[model samples]
Target: MGQGETEKIAGELIRQAVMLLMDRNEDITLSSVLNILADFQMRAFNTGQLNACIQAIADVSAAKSGSLREESALKDKVAGKCSSCRSSDNVTTLH
Candidate 1:
């Protein structure tokens, strides 16, 4: 799947999970979200979608555990900006 598609699926899964867990009076941790996604994987979601969803959850969890500023920075990264510098104009490639 393309990066944009992956991000969209991941974002949707994360958003809904937060809502569902809130309705159930449960905490919406990364693991909880991942389990929800995993259950969906067995029935409907494909492997690629599941993987992307899990990755996105992990990223959010990691950022949350760190500084609050990192959360905004991580969001920028989600938007395809460089995590270190938050720039999309300059391209960096490694071989």
Candidate 2:
């Protein structure tokens, strides 16, 4: 298609995506819209913008997921430990 035709189609897609998110009570931020468009592109074109940045996005997501997992595990390990169990008298702070 011509550039103009492609742009018009993209504009309509954006409007539809935004309205769909609004209807679903989803957040309407740039990231939300872009994510929707990314999914649509995957469905319609089988690929697009993500081709350029997929590796970077994957790296970031994986790193954050690992960090969150570690944080959760640490919380689980540290929980239920009350330093205020006392030395038979006063309380102790867990620093």
Predictions in order: lDDT:
0.67, 0.58
Q: Count of backbone clashes for each model?
A: 0, 0
Worst 10 residues of 1 by lDDT: 86-95
User: What is candidate 1's CA lDDT for residue 90?
Assistant: 55
TM-score of 2: 0.47
Give the per-residue lDDT digits (tens) of candidate 1, residues 1-95. 87788788778877777788889999877678766766555554477777776666676666556756667676766665765554566525310
How well does each candidate superpose onto the true structure, as a TM-score? Answer: 0.49, 0.47
> Which 10-residue window in model 2 sums to the lowest lDDT?
48-57
- Model 2: clashing residue pairs? none
**Superposition TM-score, candidate 1 onto the true structure:** 0.49
